[model samples]
Target: MKMQKTNKWILIYGVIAALLIALHYVLQLSVFEVWNEYVPFLEKLSMSLFLIALIFMVSKIIRKLINTRAHLEGDRYNLLRITRLLAIVSSLIVATSFLFQNLYAAVVSFGLISLIIGFALQAPITSFIAWIYLIFRRPYLVGDRIQINGLRGDVVEINYLDTTMLECSGDYLVNDRRSGRIIRFPNSLILKEEVINYSGPDFPFIWNETPIQVAYTSDLEFVEECLLAATNRDFREHYRHFAAHEWEEWEPAVYFRINTYAWMEAVISYPVEPRDTTGRRNRILRYALALLNEAPDKVQFPEGTLR
Candidate 1:
């Protein structure tokens, strides 16, 4: 549908250009006639339209190429952005060059104009610069879950001045589920605020802990064993091969802690994929609870009241 629209406009421009050329010959309109200065203006206008149509056609082709060749979403998006930027810049340069007969004068004038615009649009310029920094620094890329300042979400788009995120945890929700709200913040904020990225080379797994409270009289060994059993059942297959090669020394472990209410706290520490944190924790807790129920005499959970 979009391609059809583009082709339609291109055809219109081609027809107009052909008509303009035919007009010059058919009407015998001289470029320097007494009252026919409109002749040259019409020619220039026609040429501009033709150039714009050509640019759009080229841009569309390049976009298709990028979409086909660039495997990663982020890479495809960035490449398309660059392509559009180049098209706009090139069109501006061509139009300006046509407008000004003297090339050097045009260059000098553009430089001064850009300097003035730079100072006038300080905030926007800063954001654009920050965008460049983001491209190189890669604090967070598209699809990466991140928390900047207090906002937490997956980056959906990174525009020239604004970064759009699909928010995860909003006011009502505490878990890491999507809130269906979107947030757009200035790119310049990256320079001012700390960015916490939950995705990286140690991807598909992040350190997570689940604390299980048991009565002080419970067998500590039994509690530890139950915690380990639940965790191993859920995560061992996922992490076993990668864990040994990527992180040679790290393994799932259970640590014991003393609670203020005299209850024994069993902290099950393990690695979990960011998206699976809540679900995995829920499963582990259910498994632990079911197993503890089987041996109630050995492992008892803390009651609501301290004593």
Candidate 2:
């Protein structure tokens, strides 16, 4: 559906450009030569239209070719953004051409104007430079969950001046799910602040721990076995995507921690994707509690308010 609409719009723009160019010549045929005053305007308009249409058509082709491949979504998004920047630049050059009679004059004039504007708009220009840095440095990419400064979210778009994210665990929510809020921060922030990208290529999973309070008299071995079994079941059932990666590196582990409430904390550390942290922890807890309840002497839960 989207491709069809794009093709239709491209055809429409092409027809408009063809008519504008032909009209530019048709009026100079001596019969309608009285309209020669409009010739220059028509010529510039036609050239701009043709160039924009051509650029968009080529960009569409390139994006379509790349969109078919899997696991290269970030690369495809970067290329799309680059092509759009190219279109803007090429259009500006075309518009500048007719404003001056010669190439040297246009270049010099635009260079001087850009120098003045660059000084006046230092913040925006710095942000644009930061955007360029993001393209190369890639601290985070589209679909990656990242936290910068105090803001935590999933990256959705990286524009020339700002980076947009879908915020997670906002003021009202306690879990890691998105809070239906949009966050737009200046790209320049990347240069000034540290970014925590949950997407790790080397580990392929975010190491997360969920703590459960149990009486110190509880069977330590049984508690560990139950927690590991619960986490392992969840991993085997829902997170099999990590199977091709390092298997031993992501194995679930249980650690005991002393609590001030006179109870022991069983912390189960496991590997999980960022988005699935909450749900995976919930499932593991449910399974672990069910298994532990079958053997009451093995595990004991806190009955008072310290839960």
Candidate 3:
């Protein structure tokens, strides 16, 4: 239904455009003979408007097609940005040609004006260039959680000169929870700083580890089993269905090593979604502690520093 409406509007635009062109030529040859100087300018302006309308209409259709298909969200967004840039460039070219009668004069005038503006807006121009790089390279996209130069957040918007992020782990919080703060940073920073994108090709999960310090006298096998049980209990569903694949076999792995405090450090490494890391770790610890307490002889937690 929406596509039909779009097609109808496109047809209407085509008819009106054809009529406008026909009327423009008719007026130039007959009705506007006395105003010859202004007639050509008027005709060119009308043609330029029609061309811009066509460009935008075609761009809209292409954007619609991309959005409806199975393309990735990042690809769709980058394509939209590229389409908009192309439309703006095309419109400017058409308008410049229509407004300037001499091609040489237009080039000279544009060069001089651009030189002046470029010098004046150097920083902003660099940021805009960075924005273009972002559109093409896709270091990150909206909804992706990222950390750059100590600011960690979910990207909310990417403007022409700046990117806005909804800050996470700010001020009072240590977890990956949003802090109700918005961070607006210049896009040019992408050129200078390393951007860590938490959600990417290995998206929906990242490796996280929980370290448990236990007495050396405890049964190492029983401690490792308890840790494994805790993680499996928390993330069994994720491991069984969404995470496991032929290319990547996702599951919890346990390792043990001796520590300086005369305690055995048992680490349970597993895959966890970025947002759920802190919560998942907390739950695993709670369950593991309960299980360890039930079997005091088998698993004993470290009490103090090394003597």
Return the top candidate by lDDT.
Answer: 2
What is the TM-score of each predicted model, taking all chains together? 0.80, 0.88, 0.82
The alpha-carbon lDDT assigned to residue 86 of candidate 2 equals 84
Better of 1 and 2 by TM-score: 2
Candidate 1 has a TM-score of 0.80
All models, RMSD in angstroms: 4.3, 2.7, 3.6
Model 2 lDDT tens row, 117-235: 99999999999999999888888888889999899999999899999999999999999999999999999999999999997555568889999888988999999999999998888
Q: What clash pairs does model 1 have? A: none
The segments of candidate 3 whose C-alpha lies over 4 angstroms from its true place after superposition are 1-19, 26-37, 102-104, 202-204, 239-241, 247-250, 257-265, 286-297, 302-307
lDDT of 3 by residue, 82-115 (tens): 7778888777776676677655677777788889
- Point out where model 1 deviates above 4 Å: 1-44, 236-250
Could you tell which candidate, 1 or 3, scores higher by lDDT?
A: 3
- Computed on alpha carbons, the lDDT of every model, listed in order, comes to 0.78, 0.83, 0.81
**Model 2 regions lying over 4 Å from their true place:** 20-49, 69-71, 244-246, 302-307
**Lowest summed lDDT over 10 consecutive residues: which window, candidate 2?**
63-72
